[model samples]
Target: MIIPFWSRLRLAPRIVLVIIGALLAMKAVDKAMPLVIRPPEAMFFDRDWLLATLQDIRDRSITAPAAERPALLRDLPVRQWLDITLLSSPPDFRHSEREGGFTDLHRRITDRLGLTPQDVLLKADEPDDPEYSPRPLVIILPPLPTVIMDVFDDRSANMLSSDLRIAFRIGPQEDWLVVTPKSDGQEIVRMTRNVALPLLAVVLIGLLSVWVARGIVKPLDDLAEAAEKLGRDREPRLVGSFNAPELQAIGNSFNAMQLRLKRFVDDRLQMIAAISHDLRTPLTRLRLFAEYLPDPDQRRQVMSDIAEMEAMMSATLTFASTQLKDEPRSPSDLAAMLISLCDTAADAGCMVAYEGPDHARLVYRPVAMRRAFANLIDNGCKFGSHVWVRLRETPDAFVITVSDDGPGIPPDQFENAFRPFVRLESSRNRDTGGTGLGLTIAQDIILTHDGDIMLSAAPDTNGLVVTVTLPRQG
Candidate 1:
C-alpha cells in the first residue's frame, strides 16, 4: 500500500526508544556473560592428593612410636589451614581416633613446620630467597558476575574462603580482581551492568541525536525568528545557508519574498513622489500668473501655496530616495561628526550643544549618516529652544541622542510621527512649517545602516528626544 509520507514516518521505528533499550540490553549482557559458571562441588579438594594424605597420616600414626610420629609428618609434604572441622560420627570408632588426629594435624601443619602464615607447605618449587617462599594459591573465583573483596593485611593465608582478593601485576597491566565466597547472592548480579554493548549503543545514538537536532530544529528556529521579525515591521533577515537541501530551498524562497516586498514598498514611495512632482510644476506656473493680480494679499496667498507645494515635492523625493542612494562607506570619527554638526547648527542660530569624548571612530556611510543627523537637529531647532546632541559609547552599541526642550508630541503619536507626511498640527502651521519627512527620512537611513531610530518624551520638558543606536562594525 502507498501510504502518505506523514503516516509512513509516524509508523517508522521509534529510534530513540529503540536505542535506549538496546544500550541497556548490551550493558547487561556484557557484564553477565563473563560469569557463566556453575557452583563448585561441595568441599572441592584434590581427590588423589587428599586421599593419599589421609592414607599416609593413618599409616604413620598406627602403632608408631611417639618420637617417630613427629618425624613421619616432617618427611611428607602437606598444606596448612585444611581440615574436616565438621564430620558425622563414623560407623567404626577406630578410624575416628586415627582420621580425626590426622585432620587436626593437617590444620596445624604451619605451626608444626614453624612457618609463618605466608609460607606454603604443599608448593613443590619454593624460591631460594627466604622471603620468596611460595604461598598457597587461593582460587576463590565467584560464581556470580561481580564481587567486592579487599586485601589490606600483609600476613595472610590465601587458601581460605574468608580473604578472597589480592593485588598483583600482569606485564604492564595492573588491576585487582575480587573473587568472593562460594555463597554468591543477588547482590553480585545487581552491581554488574551489561556495560560493553550499552557503551557502544549510547555513543552511536548520542551522535545521531546531535546530527538530527542540528539538521532539523536549529535551522527551523532560525527561520522562525527571521519570519517573526519581518512580520513585526522589522528588517527582513537572512537565513544564510543550510545543510539540508529542503531548508536551502526554503531560505531562497524567503529571500525572494523579501525582494518582492522591498520592490512593492519602493514602487509605492515612487508613486507618491511622482504625484507630488506633477502637482508642483502646475503650482509654480500658477504662482507666476498670480503675480499680475491687482490685489497684494491675493497674490501673496497664491505664492505661499506654490512654496508649500514645492516643499512637499522636495520632502517626497528625500523620503522616497532616502538621501544619496550611494553614500561611500568610510571610517568616520563619531565625536568629530557630532562636534561638526553642533558647530554648524550653532552657526545657523540654533541653541545646540555637543557632549562626549574627542575621538570615537566607526565605519559608516559618512554622507547619508550626516543627513540623518541634520534632519534630527533641524527638528530640534524648529520645535524647541535648546537642542542637546550627545554621543556616547556603550559595551554593545554606540548611542546618539538629539534632545529638544519644547512642546513635544503626545506619547501615543511618538511612532506615528515618523511616517511620511504625518506631521503634528502644531508643526503643520505656516509659522512652524515642515513637510514632515524629516523624521521619516532619518529613520529610513538608520534602518539601511542596520541601526535604529527611537523617539521618547524628553525629561524636564514637553519636547521629544530622538535616539539612534548603531551596532559597531569591525
Candidate 2:
C-alpha cells in the first residue's frame, strides 16, 4: 500500500516531501540535543545556579545576629538584585503562594534551611496594585550577564516588569527575604529563538528543494512536448540540454530515435516513387504495341486493360510524389475554398452543396489542401448523387465533413478503405471507384498538414461521411 501511494506522487511533490521529512528529522535531533549533550551557556539559563544563589543568600542573612541583621543584609555583597531590609514591626505585606516552579523553589529553600514549608512564603507581584511596582533588574552573574541582556532586551524587559517577589521569615527574627524571581519572559524568548531558527532553516531548505526539483522535472516536460510534436510532424526539434546526467542521456536517445524514424519514412517513400517511375515506360510500350494488334476487338480489349493499368500506376506515382513534396503554408479563407470546390462540382452536374461561414481564415498549404478536399468531394460525387460539404472552425482546428447519400462501407472495412489500392467489393465497380486511391490520397495530404481524416456513416443517412480535421493558424 505504501509503495503504491508513493508511486502515485509526481517527482516534484515527492522532492518536496523528502525535504519536509529531512527538516522534521533535523528538528527532532535539535529537540533531543539538550537531553543527550549539554548545550552552550548562551542557549539556555542555568536554573541550578539561580537556586544555589538564592539558598546562599538565605543562609547568610539568617546566620547574622538579629541586632546587626539589617546592616548585614544591606552589605551582603550579593548581586545587586533584592532590597534586603529588616522590618522593625511584623511585615504588613501578606504573601500568598503561587503556582508554577516557585512552589518547588519554596520547598527547596525550606528543606535546605531545615525548616517547615510554612516558614517561607512566595508571592507574585500584582501589577494592578497602585502601591507596588516591580523594577526590572538583572540577577544572573557575569559572562552570562551579556548573554541574558542580549536575549532579554527592552521589549522583553517591558513584559517582565511585574516580577515575582518572595517574602519569608527565618524563625522569629522579623527579617524577611524580599527577592525577585527569575524572568519568565527571558526563558520564553530563548525557547522561541530555538524553535524559530530551525523553522527558518527549514523554510530555506524547502526553497532549495523546489529549485532542484524544477531543474530535474523541466527536461521530462520538454521530452513530453517533443513527443507530441513528433506525432503531428515528421521534423520535430531536438530537446535542449539538461543538467542531470540521466535526463541528458534520455534527450540523446530521443534525438537518435527521431532521426531513425525520419530516415525510415523518407527511404520508403523514395523507393515507392522509383518503382512507380520505372513501371511507366513498360506500360507506355504495351499501349503502343496493343494499337498494332490485328483483331480489332482484341486490340480494343488490350488497350482498355493497358489504360486501366496506366491509370493505377499514375495514381500511385502521384500519391508517392505528393507525400515527398513540401508545401509552403499561407493564410487562406477556408469557407471560401470549400464553397468554390462545391460550386465547381455543382457546375459539373454533381448535386453538391456547401454549408459554413463566408470567410474563415487559416494558415495552410493552399494547393495541397485544395487537392485533398477535391479528392474527397469528387469521391462523394462518384459514389452518391448528392454530396453535402460542411465546414466548422474550432479554437485549435477546422473540422470539415463531406457526406454522400450512397451506400456506406461496412464499419469493419472503414479502416481498410484508407489503405492505398484497397477497394471494397461493394464500391469496386469501375463506374464508382477509380484506382482505389482517393481516400488514401486525401488522408495522406491531411496527415502531412498535421491533421487527420476519418470515415464514418453519415448521421441520419445511409451514406459515408469523411471527416477532416486541420489545425488552425497560430
Candidate 3:
C-alpha cells in the first residue's frame, strides 16, 4: 500500500497533495463541529429576561398560601429553556464556596433583578439527602453530549433529582430561587478547530518542509566537499551517484573535469621530465670539454660556468620530479618534525632554535613537507646568524613560523623572490650560491597541500619571517 501511494506522485504533486489534504481536513472539521457540540442555554436566553422571570416566580411563590406555594412555583409558565423547581425545608444541600462557583453569574443576575448581592444565595453541588438514589442525575441531548452540571460553573442542577418543592417563612413569608445553566459545547469545538488543529497542522508542515529541504540541500553540500578535496589533491576520489537528476548531472560533470585536469597535468610533467633528462648528457659532455682547456684561467672560468649551469639544471629537475600530490599522507608528530629539523640545522652550526608543543599529530605528506621547511630553514641560515622556529595549533589549521635575524628583503621584492631564478640583489646576491628556486619550490609544495606560505619582516628585528599555514584534520 505504501509503495503504490508513493509511486503515483512526483515531488511537485506530493507537495500539492499534502497542502490540499490539510486544508480539506480543517474544512471538514469546521463543518461538523456545530453538529457535534451544542451552545449553552445562556447564549439563547437574555440574562435580563431570565433574571426577571426568576424574580417574578419567587415573588409569586412568596405571596401564595403555604399549601399552594409548591404548585405555584412548579407551574410558573416559564420559558421552555428553563427548568424550575422547589425543594422542601432541610433540602439537605451541601454548599461549597470555592472555584467553579457561580459568584459572577449570581452577582449579574442579582443586579439585573434589582436585588443586592446579599439577597441572593448561591451554592454548588446537590442537597445531602439520605433517601436520594446513589446514582447521579444524567441529562440526555441527542447528537450532542449532555453534562448534568451547570455549563458556566460546576454546580449541579437540584431540579434533576426532584420536582418543585419550596420552603416558606411562617410569619413573613418569603422564598429563595436557585438556577442552573447548561454549558455551550461550541466553545470546545471552536478551540479545537481554530487553535488545536491549526497548531498541530503547523508542526506537521514544518517537519515535512525540513525533510524536503534536506533532500535537496544534502547533495549540493556533498558536491561542494568533493570540489574542495579535488583542489587539495591531484588524484581526488570522484563524487558518487546521487538520487536527484540535477545533482547527478553535476557530479558527472565534476568527475569529467577532474579527469581532464589530471591528464593535462600528467602530460606536462612527463614532457618536462623527458626534456630535462635529455639535456643532462650534453651538460656532462660540456663539463668534460671544459676540463681539457689549455689556459688555466680560461679553464677555471669555463668550469665555474659549467657548474652554475649544472646547479640550475639540477634544481629544475628536482622541482619537477618532486610532485607534492604524489606523496601519500600519514599521521606524524608535526612538533617533533619541526624540532628535529631545527636540531639538524643547529648541529650544522646554524644558530636555530625550536619552540612549540612537544607532540602535535597531523596527517600530512612528511617527505614533501620536510623538504619545504628545509628550504626555508636553509635560506635563513645562509642569510642570517640566528633562526627561530615556532609551531602553533589553531582550531582549523596549524601554523609554523621561521624567523631569521638577517638583512630583510625589500618589501617590493617579496613577490619577485618567489619567482623561479629571481633573487634580490640588495639582500640575497649570487654570492650566496643559491639557484634562487627554493622559495618557489616551497610555495608550490605548500599550495599543492592546500596550505599557504607567507613572507614578512621579523617583528623584533630586520629579517625575513616565513609562515606556513596548513589545514588541521577534523
Candidate 4:
C-alpha cells in the first residue's frame, strides 16, 4: 500500500502546523459571527419622574440666597442639583453656539438674564460634586462666562460636548435626560475580535510551519549520514526511500552515483593496461641495442641502467593496470601478509620484524596489497638499519605500520616523499635509484582500496613510521 506524501511528515513540526491551523479557524469564526448582530443602550428616570420634576421647580420658586440654597435643596435628592443650575443660569443663556441641543435651557436663561437676541450663549456640564446630583442641561450667556455648572450623565449632553448637534431645552429643576447616539458595544467587540482573531491565526500557522520544517529536515539528515558512510568506504548501508518525492529522488540519485563510479574505475584500469603494452615495446628495443657498446665499464653501466629501468617500468605499469580493476575477492588475513613481507625483506639482507596480532583481516586487492607492502619494506631497507612492521586491527579497520631505526627525515620534507618523480636524497650520488614512482604508486593503490596513508616520526625508534589503514570487511 502506498502512503500519501503528506504522511511522511515527522511528528514535531506537524504538531506546530496543526496548532496554527486551529487559530486561523477560530479567527474566521469570530469574524463571520459578529457581522450578523447589532449594538446596547443606557437608561435613566421614567417619563413620570421627568415631568413631575419640571412641575415642582415651576411652583416652588425659592427666595433663598446662595448659602441657604444648599441646605434647602438638600431636602430632596433631586433638589440638590437645582441650586447648582440657578448659580450658572445667567451664562447658560450666553454663548449660544456652545449650548449644543439645549435650546430650552437657553431660552429660560435668556429670559432670566433679560438678554437681547444678539447676546451670545454657552452651555456646559456641571462639575461633579459628592453633595450634588445629576442635572442634564445648561445654557450660557456672556455675563455668566466666568463660571459653569449643569449638563449631566445624559448621553445627549456628551453629544453636545462633542459638537454633534445643537442642544435645545427650557428650564431649571427639570429632569430631561439626554442620550448620545453611539454603537460603543459593537465598536469594542469588533476591536477585540480584530486583535484576537489574527493572533490565533498566526499561532496556528506557526505550528504548521514548524511541523513542515521538521518533516523536510529529518530525511535529509539521514541521507547525509548514509552518503558519508559510503564515502568513507564503509559497508553499503541501505536506507529506504521516503514518501516525500524529493527525498526519494535523492536516495535514487546516490545509488546511481555509486554504480557509475565503480564502472568508471573498471573502464579506466582497462585503458591504463592498454597504454602499458604500448610503453614496453620501445624500452625492450633499447635494452637489446645496449649490448653493442665498446668500453667494458660503460657496457656494464648501460646494462645496469637498462635493468633498473625495466624493473621500475614493470612496477609502475603493474600498479596502474590493477589499482582500479582489482575487485576485492575476499578479506585476506593482514597479519599473514605483513609477516610474509618481513621474511622476504630479511632474506634480502635487511633486519625486519613484525609486531601486533597474529590474525587481523582486511578487504583488498590481493596482488595490489602485496605490491604496496613490498615497496614500503624495500624503502625501509634502503633508508634504515632495522625495520619493524606492526599491526592494529579493530572491528572497523586494520592499520599496518612500518618503523625503522634509521636517521629521521627532515621535518619539512615529509610530504615530498609522496610526490611522483620528486626525490629527496640522503645519499649524494645518483647510484641509489628507481622510478621515483614507488611510494607514489603505493599510495594510489591504498587510496583506491579505501585506505589512508600517513607518515610520522616513529615513537622512540628514531626514524619515520609509515602507516596504512584499510577498512575491515564486515
Candidate 5:
C-alpha cells in the first residue's frame, strides 16, 4: 500500500507539526472545558458584601480620629473573603482617551458611600503583564496608581474583565482605602490548572518527538546492516517498509545496485567455467598425440605438460563453478566433519590427527565448507610430514587451525599465496599435486560465509599454521 504524504514527512517537520497540533488541541480543550462544566451564579462577584464593606470603611474614616484612621482600616480582619488595606494616596490609573464603560459602576460606588463621583474610582480588568501581574502590582503602580488585589473566582482575577474593583479616599483628611476580595484555595487551584495545561502539552509533544526520532533512525540502521552484509559478500535481507519517502528511495536504489553487482559477478564466473570446460577437450587431444611421439623423452615431456594443463583446467573449472553456485546455509557438525577428513587422510597413510570438541554445530553451506576444509587438510598433508587439525571456539566465532611441520612460507609471501595459480616454491610445489588454487578456492568459500583465514608460523614448530575463523550465528 502507498504511504500517505503525512506519514512520510521528514523528522524535523513531523515533530514541529505534532507540537503545533498538540498546542491547538490543548487550546480547544481549554475553551470547551468550561462549557462542559459551567459554574453556578453563586460563584460570581458578591456585589452586596463588597458595597457594604466599602460603606463601613468610609463611615469609620469619618468617625475615627485622623491619626487612628489608618490603624482602623489596617486592623480590620480579613473576613468573608474581603481584604481591606489603607494607602497614603490613590494609585496611578490607565487614563482612557475616551470615557470607558465603567462610568455607571463609578457612580454606583460613590452613591453607596454618600460621596461624589470624583471621590470614587472603578477599573475593569486589564490585560496582564507578566512582570506587572503576580507581583504586589506596586512596583509598576504609578505615583498615584490604582490598587489591584487578587479575588477568588473560577478564573484568574487578572482574566475576569467584569469584576467590581473600587479605590477611593475614605475622608477628606484620611488616607485612601483599597477594598477587594482576597483569593481562596479555589483560586489557587484555578491558577494551577491554567499553568499545568501548557506544561502537560509540552511533555506530550516531547514524547511524540522521541517516537518520530526512533522511526527515522530505525530505517537508517537497517540500511547500515545491509551494507555491512554486502561488504562481507553475503546476500542480506533488508526490511522493505519505511516511514519516510527519502529512506524508501535510498532502499530501492541500494537493492537495485546489489542485484546488478550479483548479476555481473555471476556472468563472469559462468564465462570462466565455460572456457575451462572447453580447454579440457584440447588438453585430452594433446595427451593422445603425446602418446604417439617417436622419441621416448619427448613423449614423456609432452605427457607431463599435457597432464599439468589438464590439472590447471580442472582446478579453474572447479573454482568458477564454486563461485557461481548459490547455496542455502544449514546447521552442520563441524567437529565431526574435521575428524572424518583427518581419518580419511590417515587411511591414505598421511600423518594427520584431529583434536577438538566431538561436536560443534554451526550454520553454513555444508557442501562448500566441507570442500574448503578438505582442500586445506590435503594441502597440509602434501607439504608437511605431520599435520595437526585443531578446532577452538571463542565467544563470537569458531577457530580452526591446521598446523603442518614443513618449511613455512615467508611472511611477505603470505598475502600472495591465495592468488589463483600463484605458488610459492618455499612452501608449495607443482610435484605436490596442487594447481596453486587450493588456498584460492578455500578463501573464496570462507569469505562467502562471512569467515576469514590467515597464515602464520607455527609457534612451537618449524611449520606453517593456517587459521580459519567463522562467526557464530545468532
Candidate 6:
C-alpha cells in the first residue's frame, strides 16, 4: 500500500528526520561491522612459531648453560615475525595486569612452558597503533561512526582499554624477555573502521542533502513561474499535489486566486462596455435633435459638443474591448509591421521613416500588438513634423523606439501621461483632438504581452521618445 510519507510531512521536520535517519543507519553499520569482519589470525603471529618458541625457552631454562642462555634465546627463529627484546632489568610493570582474555593466555603459556607465575607477566590493551604499541590478545575493533573520529590522536584511540605488555624470565635473576607482534595488518583494519568509513558516510550525507533539496525546490520553482505567467495575463493554475502539505496548500490558494482575479477583471470590463454602449444611443438622438435647432451658431456649437462626446464614448468602448479580448499569440514579423505603419503615415503626408532590420520574428498577439505600435507612431506624427520608428535587437529582447521632434513632456508628467484620459496640456494642446486614451491603451496591450513601455525626452530636440521593450519568448 502507498503510505504517502512525504505528503504528510512539513519541510523542516522532513529534513531533520532525513539527517537523523542517516546517522542512525551509519551507527548500525558501524556496530555490526566488527562481528562480520576480523583480521586474519595468522597476520598477527604464526601459532606454530609461538608454541615452538615457548617450548624452546622452557628447555633452555633447565638444560642450557646459564652463561649461554641469553645467546640461545636471542637466536630464536621467531624473531622474523615477532620482536624479542632482552633487557638488563625487568621492564616497567607498574600498570600491567592480566585480565579477561589476557589472564587465560598467561595461564596457558605458563602451563605449556612449565614456568612459574612469578616468572611470567601478561597485560593486554586496546591499542591505537598496534604496530607501535602492545595490542590485546583478543583484538577489539573500533566502534561508533562519527565525524569526531577524524581528529583522533593516539591517546584518544587507546582510551577504550589499558596498556598491554608481556614479560618473562628464564630464571629469577636472568634478563627479562619481552615479545611483541611486528605485523601492521591490525592497524590497517582499525584505520579502515575509524577513519575511512566516516569519510564515506560524509559523502553519502552530502549526496542525500542534494537529493532532498532538489525535491523541495522543484515545486517552488513551478510556483514562481506560474506567478510570472499570471502577471502577463496568462491564466495559470498550480497543481494541488505538491510533495509537502504546506506547499500543497499554497498551490491551492494560488489556483483559487487566479480564478477569482480573472473573474473580477472580466466583470469590470463587461460593466464598462455595457455603460459605454448604452450612452451612445442617447448621444445619437441628441445629435439628430441638434441638427434641427433654429440658431446656426448654437446648432454648430451643440453638434461639435455632441461629436466630442461621441468620440470619447467610442474611445472608452475600444478600451473596454481591448481588455476583454483574449487573443491567441503567434509568431509574427514585427519589423515588417513597423515599416508598414511608417509607410501608411508617410502616405498621409507625415514625414515618417523606418530604420532597422527587414525581418524580426516575435511571438505576440498580432492584432493587439499592431494597434499598440500604430498608436505610438500616429501620436508621434500628430505632434511632430518628422517621426522616426526604429527597431533594434538584443540578445534577450527586442526594442522598438518611436521618437517625434515635437514639444516633449516634462520629466515630472511622464507617469501621469499614461493614466486614462490624462492629457499634458502644456506639451499636448486641445487642438490635437486626442481623447488621451492612446498611450493608456498602448500600455495595457504591451504589458499584457509581458513587455515594457516607457516615455523619455528626445536626446537632441524638444520631443517625446517612446521606448518599448519586449522579452524574447522561447
The per-residue C-alpha lDDT of model 5 at residue 465 equals: 95
User: Whose lDDT is higher: candidate 1's or candidate 3's?
Assistant: 3
lDDT of 1 by residue, 1-474 (tens): 674442233212434554666577666755565475222222223323443444445444444654464565444444242421111221111111223223343345434433343321122121232111122223321223322242112113212222222111111222111111234343334223324335666776677667555566777898888886664333578788765556667889987887788678878988987897788778877978998989999889888877877877887887776445466678898788878988999999999998888888888888878888998998899889899999889987799999999788888888888877777766533468788788888887777666888889988888888999987863
Residues 251-345, candidate 4: write the lDDT tens digits.
78877776677577656756765665676787778777877877888889888987876776676566556434446657787788889899989
Q: List model 6 lDDT by residue over 77-152, tens digit each.
A: 7656556666668777643453444455566667877778777777656545433332333232224433444323
lDDT of 3 at 337: 87
Candidate 6: worst 10 consecutive residues by lDDT? 151-160
Instruction: Return the lDDT, model 1, position 129.
Output: 26
The global C-alpha lDDT for each of the candidates, from Candidate 1 onward, is 0.60, 0.70, 0.68, 0.59, 0.72, 0.75
Residue-wise C-alpha lDDT for candidate 5, range 1-474, written one tens digit per residue: 897888668766887887788788877877774575332122234344455767887888778987887677677764455567677777466422224324444555678888776677665554253221221221111123233453322122122432334678876654677665553334444445557767877777777777777878888888887887765564545558687777778888888887777778778878988988888888888888888999999999888888777878877887877443377888999999999999999999999989999999998888888888998998888889999999999999999999998888889999999988898876477666668999998888888777899999999887899999999962
Q: Which stretches of candidate 5 lie over 4 Å from their true place?
A: 1-3, 7-12, 15-146, 149-210, 228-243, 293-301, 322-331, 394-397, 406-433, 450-452, 455-457, 461-463, 471-474
Ranking of all predicted structures according to lDDT, beginning with the best and ending with the worst: 6, 5, 2, 3, 1, 4
> What's model 2's overall lDDT?
0.70
Better of 3 and 5 by lDDT: 5
Instruction: Name the lDDT of candidate 5.
Output: 0.72
Top-TM-score candidate index? 6
The clash count of every prediction, one per candidate, is 4, 0, 7, 49, 5, 0
* Candidate topping lDDT: 6
> Which sections of candidate 6 miss by over 4 Å?
1-3, 28-203, 211-216, 234-239, 290-307, 322-325, 409-417, 423-433
Clashing pairs in 2: none
